[model samples]
Every structure is written in structure tokens, then in C-alpha cells.
Target chain A: MNGLNGIGVKVVHVGGNGNAHAVLREIEARLQLLVEKGEEGSIDLSGLPLMPEDYDLLEETLGEGEVVAEVHSLGPTRIHETGIPGVWWVTHYNSDDEVLAEFIEVAWCPEILLTPEDDVKDGLEALRARLFELNPKSPLGGAPSLDL
Target chain B: MRDETLLDTLKRRGISRRGFLKFCATTASMLALPPAMAAEVAAALGKVRRPAVIWLSFQECTGCTESLTRAHSPSIESLIFDAISLDYHHTLQAASGHAAEEAREHSMKQDWGNYLLLVDGSIPLKDDGVYSTIAGISNLQMLKDAAAGAAAIVSVGTCAAYGGLPHANPNPTGAVSVSEIIKDKPIINVPGCPPIPAVLTGVLAHYLTFGAIPDLDDLGRPKAFFGESIHDRCYRRPFYDQGKFAKTFDDEGARNGWCLFELGCKGPTTHNACATTKWNGGTSWPVQSGHGCLGCSEPDFWDGGSFYKALSTPISPVTGAAAAAVAIGAAAGVAIGLANRQTKAAAKAAHQKATIADLEK
Candidate 1:
């Protein structure tokens, strides 16, 4: 690919009607640990909105890359059980670190007063800093940091 | 009248002097020659006596003529009548039946070993050349006879250049290219479904000015225009290089104006001036209009697979894990994510607009 950094990343989106609840539950259920869900004001989940408020938010809230939106799959078999509509949000993070770490705080929820546009311009940048701290080797995984 | 200059013959035939000059200039520019060369063109074309052009139509439609006549930029009239002496053309000639045959013969005899052989279609050797005929004479016989005394042969279409559509799959006519028949004479293959009129005129202008054919490719096509593939000049090639492709006509990729390779574009394999020269007064080529290249200028393009399939090898990561790894870490991952999202949103918006309009109605 042209101008590629050669570092591949996957945007894994996990969503449901109550994404915060679901993510919290998954972390708890899988690792058997409790997470102090941050207060609504302290956390910025505007970039992860489940619904479209504007063109920018709508763009960020849907698709497999960085954001994901839930839509009916309409697959051939077992359509009823797996066909239910759900919220989806995508984020580019190292999967190996995510798989290795026992617990971590992530703010991908669009609801809880988070808009696509946030008051903190560098809030995502700080969140990235915290994410890297939790797993020191996350950024050193030989993946090209194609971050613009 | 017999001793009239070429310009005087054109004037007697009702072609304007200004039209003749315009044709000369356009020819010069098309050939990428210096503007000063136009004077050389006008001088050479003005002094020569009526040069004989024996045009043989073989196994193909008259699209080449239609395109030729529709050359309003320089105007085909200026090229055919003002520039050279078009002695025999089946479509344009007034005489028919025995008189038409006689006209070709008389012109051949009149300008022996000097006339130009302009072939617009391919010849079928199958069943004794029964695929196409004129006045009870096979195209093969007429072409051979016309070519016998001709100085050079100009194959004007893909049919004549590379056995175009008639030579496609299960070809019942056993169509053969003009190169196969007239090997001795200098053959210039202008291979397009109907090549750009400017290209045709350019070749003629170069020949008329220099008294020799321009440099030709291995395929006998003039190297000036057919040297580069359409893909090399396509504006959308950036999108292809970035790994962006329009998956379907109505998809987000299409709405985002992504690469059309996934949709079967033959731009990579097909060489032509369409990308640079453009069509209909240099407005846009087919890809700009949301259609992929069908590779019309290449040999046997008609028999090629679906027009939307990309001609080159796939360049994306081979394995899913590899693709996912690249997708997850690289900023390209962000771009890929953004591209997918943007495409989807655009599609959704279009769908919404259509639905709302329908509901309003």
C-alpha cells in the first residue's frame, strides 16, 4: 500500500444497548475483577456515541475500523438469535496486550454525556498515554505507529 | 485543374483555406511536434498532387468512420480531403457497383507505387473471405491488390491492428490482422475500438511532414500515444495505491469515489491516450464517469473477462492475520477505519435521501 507504515492493527468493536455495562461486565466476568466506573464528567465517551448527532459523530460511530455501529446481520442460519440489533464502537488497540492484561479502563462509550466533539482537545491523547502505561509493551510491539 | 496544387484541389473541392490550416495545426499539436512544424505540414500538404488513399473496409462496423467523421475538433473533412487525396473509400465514395471497383483500380494505376493504403477493418481468411465483401470482390483480394502498389499501409482500428471483435472467441470467420496480409509495406496500427481522431491525424501529419512513419512499438503501433497504459495516467490511481477500492456500484466505496479496480477496470493492461487526451473535447474518460475501463484499445479486449475485474495481481496482505495486524496498529488502520465509516455514512445518507423523497411523493 502507498505510504503505509507496515504496522497492522485491528479495530475490535464491542457494543450492546448498554455498552459501558457490557464492557464492564465482560471485564468482570472474564477476569473476575471489579472496576470503578468513572463518573460521567470524568470520562469522555463522545467519540463512541451509539447514534448519529452530526456528520462527524455519525462517521466516527459506525464501521469496523475505529468506530462500529450495530445493524441487523440477516445471516442465513439462526437468524433470530444472532439478528438482534446492538450498538457497536471500534478502537485501534493492540490485541495481544489486551489479551494479556488482567484489567484496564477504556472510554469507548458514546453515551453518558460524551459527544463526538469533546471539550478536551487532547483528551484522547491523554487516554492513549494511560493505555500505554497500563501495558508498557503495547507501543513497542514492532507495529508501525501509522498514527497521524 | 489537372495541374492544380493540393490546396487548389481542396479549394476546388469546396474546403476552406482556413480549415486546411486549422487541420495542419491540430495535426502538429497531436503529434507533439513544434508549432513551426505546422508550416512544414501546410507547405508539404499544399504542394503535393492529389495523393491516392485506397481505404479498404473489412470485417468491422463503420464506427471508425463515424468517429473519423465526428472529428469536429480538427474535423475529419480537413484530414481526409484537404490533407490527402482520398481516392477510394466505400462509405464516402459516390460511385458504386462496377464504377467503385474501377475507381480503386484507376486510382491505383494513376498513382502507382505511391498511394497510401488505409485499412479500417480486419480481413477474414475463413471460407474464402465470405465474412465481408464489396461488389462481389473479397476484402482480402481488394486489400492485396490495393496494397500491391501502396507506399505504406495504415491500419486504422483495433480490428485491422489486432483482429479486434471479429477475431474474438470462437471466431467463425478466421479473422486475420492486416499485418499478417501486408507484411512488406510499412504498417502503422492505430489500435483502438475507434482511435482518437487526433492520433490518426497525428500519424498522418508526422508521415506527411517527415516523409517517414514515426517511431513504432513492437506491436507496430505508433509509440507516441500507445506507449503508456491508461492506469499510469489515471487520477484515481492514488486511491488504488492506498488500497482503497469501490466494492460495488452502490456501496460506500463508490460514494467515496474510491478506486474501481475491484469493479473490473482494465486500465492497467490497456494502453491509450484516453487518460491524457480525454474524450468529447477533453472533458473526462470513462472512469471519471463512474465506469471502469473495458480495455477497448488492447488486442482482444472484447474477449477479456469482466470489465470490472482488476487486471493486475492483488496487492493486499495474503493472510487474514497479516491483514488484521496491519489494520490494527498502523495509522492506516485509522485511515481504513475512517474510510469504511465515511463510505458507510455516505451510502446511508444517499439511501436516506432516496427514501425520504419516495415517501414525500
Candidate 2:
């Protein structure tokens, strides 16, 4: 589940061991500081024990927005944009559907969501070749009629 | 009137200035004031005259008194009480009969129209208030008499504040709170079966510092302590929002420290500092000890049925859908199969035959 992006290098832990609101209080405090500083940061959740309930909290707290994109490398890595701009919910999993990593990335756009430049070059060539196939031969190259 | 200031007394008793400041800091935080106010509290408290406090008991158990008197590590609280000229407290005073009566009268006359009058139990007006008497004076009569010249009255327990157990169902004593009778005075309700030690003390500290009653809620309860419901401040609240609950005590959920909302925890409605301040001096409160809140702080809580019953079934719908969820779980899988070609192409472009040196990298 996507979590609320938190503050500067600070991991507000929502532990299952009865620290029910430690994270909520930390979030409240960080929100107060964010207003003063006019910047944001991500919540590091690598520490502490987590559970399904914790995932529900992440979903409820971060809040989902439109624009979901899935990437596949080792496994499916889904990226979701949250209601807040510059906030992203990223979850990477292995082929077995076992979660590898999950994080709330805070930025203009998470690096994982964008295609790398070298890969884009290949995409350009593939699109040109598709145009060549669409029209076996054309006086002015069929790419001129391409909507993209 | 004794002119020796609190600072003077504490210094004589070997309590350093730092010790007094630390106590003031704890007092400030407990009262929900900014930490910086501690110094101001210390400065104001150190200069003030040992204000006279007259404590009266009526129809109730002595649990409230026990909470304060039996407080562990009573040094700081004791010193503060010592700093105050507690002219009369029935349970703590060494005087008997006429002497106790005379001391009350004396303190009343000395600090007339200024002394703090603390009432701990509900006053019964039944049978011409003959049910409970102190010094042969009816509770109603004694209450009216004592309230006459007091600066303000503090209803120190649920009984004195909201006619606690004595006014519960059947209402045998026809008991009433101090506010029901004394309508003119400003009353501070520190209502709890037995209020937290620092809460009442915090109210006293506020009064001692500001010379006025702190902000109060509608029920005459102090806003600082009773401002938020126990559920909001509870440590197991995440479990509630996550729809996880412990159905019965000692179940797996209970052992996992899940929310006890299903176990009739009245924490959602009850307002008190027990969760934050904790009993046994920060050791644990009722919820921390593995039980739902009994809502003891609320008015007429004794009438609230069976403490083990859940507040409401907040998780029945989730449990009802578990079977359906298991069936549809496969169909709800992510549609990522078709998108794998681009990833495969990218991997093929990046792949290199493994060499022994690549393993190290």
C-alpha cells in the first residue's frame, strides 16, 4: 500500500507494538514544520515491524489519486500518484508476488515513473520502424500522418 | 497568616532550586501549558503566600483521597501540599472532633472570601440531609456554610462533580453534586472515580499560578485533562482505524495488542488523562493493563451497562466479506501480464553473459 510521504530524513514509525499514534503525532508535528519551511520529505519505513493493518493505514493516510502506472523488470513495480502533488506511492514486488520494497516518494516525479533516456532512443527507432511497416513505401514517409 | 514563601520552605527542607523548577516543569506540561511557563510558575509559586485549602468529605468512598495521598514518590506533591497551608483535610488531619471543627472555622474566618474550598463527595439532601453528617452538621448545611466565604469550590471527585455512584440507579441517597447547591461559585470539576494525581494537582498549580480557574469544559471539568476522548489519545487507536479488533480478552488479537474497541472499551466516549498521565505514576492505565476503559470519568458511569460489552460492532462487515474476498482475490490481480514485453526487451538490451567478476559488483 502507498503511504503518506513524510518529513526530512525522519521515519515516523507506526509500530504494531502498541505505538498506535506515534506516527500520527509525528506527522502532525512534521506538517506543522512543513508549513513553516515550505518543503517536504519522504517517510522511511524500513525500520520496525509492520502488518496488513499498517498497509491499510498507508492507503488511508497517503490517499490515492488518478494516474496509476505499472512497470515490469524483475517483477511488477506499480507507481501511483497521490492526491498531493509531487507525492508518489511506489511498491516493487518479485515475480512470486512477494513484496520487495514499498515507499512514499516525494518529488516532482519519482525517478522510477520516467523512462530512461537511452531506452527512449530505442522507442523512437521502434516507432519509426512501425511507421515504415504501416506504409511499405511512401513518397513522403508515412510518419507525417502519425498522431504521435 | 504565615509569610514564609514556598521557596523558603523548600530550601529549608533541602529541596534545591533545580528540584523545584523540575516539578514546575512537570506541572506545566500536565496542565497542557507551554514548557516555558514552568519558570513563570516557579517564580509565581515561590512568592505566593501559603494559600489555605479546606477539604470536606460527604457521601462517598475515600478512593479519590486515596489516589492523591497514596501517590507514589510523594516528595514533589507532598512538598507542594506542604507549601500550601492545607488548614483542614479530614483524612490527613491529626485533629479530632472539636479541634477539626475549630480549625475549619478558624481557616474560614482567616482566609474568608479567599480560601479554596475542596469538596470530594456528593451531598445528600434526603431526609433533611441527615444521611451523612460531619461534626453533627448535615452535608447540605455544612456545604452551604463552607461555600459562603470561599473564593472558589473544586469538586474533586465524580461524586462531588456529577453525583457519581451515590446518585447511580435506584438513587437511594437522593444525592446531588456541590454545583447543584452552590450555584454562585466557580467550581472546577476534577471528575474521575479517582482522578489522576497530577490532574487535580495541575488544577491547583494553575490556580496557584494564575489566581483564577483555568479554562473549563461544559461539565465544569478542566479542559486540559478532559479535552480529548481517551480513544483519540489511545496507543491502540491505529488498530481501530485499520478495522482490527480483539474480540475477547487473551485471544490472538489481544496477545498481539490489537484495539479493544470490541471489548466494550468506552474510551471513545470517556475523556480523561489516564491514557497520557497513566496511573501508578506513569506505569500503566486500564487499557495498558489489558482491559477496556470503564469510562469511570464520565458522569453516572456506574449506570453504563456491562463494561465487557463492545461499544459497537465496528468490524462485523469486514469479517462478513472475508469469504467473498478469498473467492474474488484471484480475479482482482493486477493486469501487469501484457506490459512485461517492454521490460523483457529492456532486460535483453542490458543483459551480459555473467562473468565471475560481475558477481562481486
Interface RMSD of each: 29.5, 21.0
lDDT of 1 by residue, B1-361 (tens): 4344555655665644434544454455566554446567778766655556788898889999887775534433353456477778889989888898898899899888988888988899999998788888898998888888999999999999999998998888999899988879999999898888767866776676566788998889888888888887676676789898899987887766677888888888888877756665443468766788888888888877656556664433358987787767787778889999999998988874357768888
Regions of model 2 farther than 4 Å from truth: A1-148, B313-361
Q: List the candidates' TM-scores in order.
A: 0.57, 0.63
Question: Candidate 2's residue-wise lDDT over B1-361, tens digit each?
Answer: 3666666777777653334544554456656765446567777766666678999999979999999885543555666687678999888899989999999999999889988999999998888988899989999999999999999999998999999989988788799999999999999999999888778887887887667798999999999889989998787887889899998898888877789988899999899988767776554578866799989889988877778877664423466588788667745543344357678888999988998898989
Question: Where is model 1 more than 4 Å wrong at Cα?
Answer: A1-148, B1-25, B34-50, B74-80, B313-361
Q: What DockQ does each prediction reach against the true complex? A: 0.00, 0.01
Worst 10 residues of 2 chain A by lDDT: A1-10
Give candidate 1's error at residue B221 in angstroms: 0.8
Which residue window of length 10 is worst by lDDT in model 2 chain B? B16-25
Q: Write the per-residue lDDT of candidate 2 for residues A21-132, one digit (tens) a residue.
A: 4544544554555567755444333222233356566567767888798876544667788775456776655454444344555555655556656457667767777867
lDDT of each: 0.64, 0.74
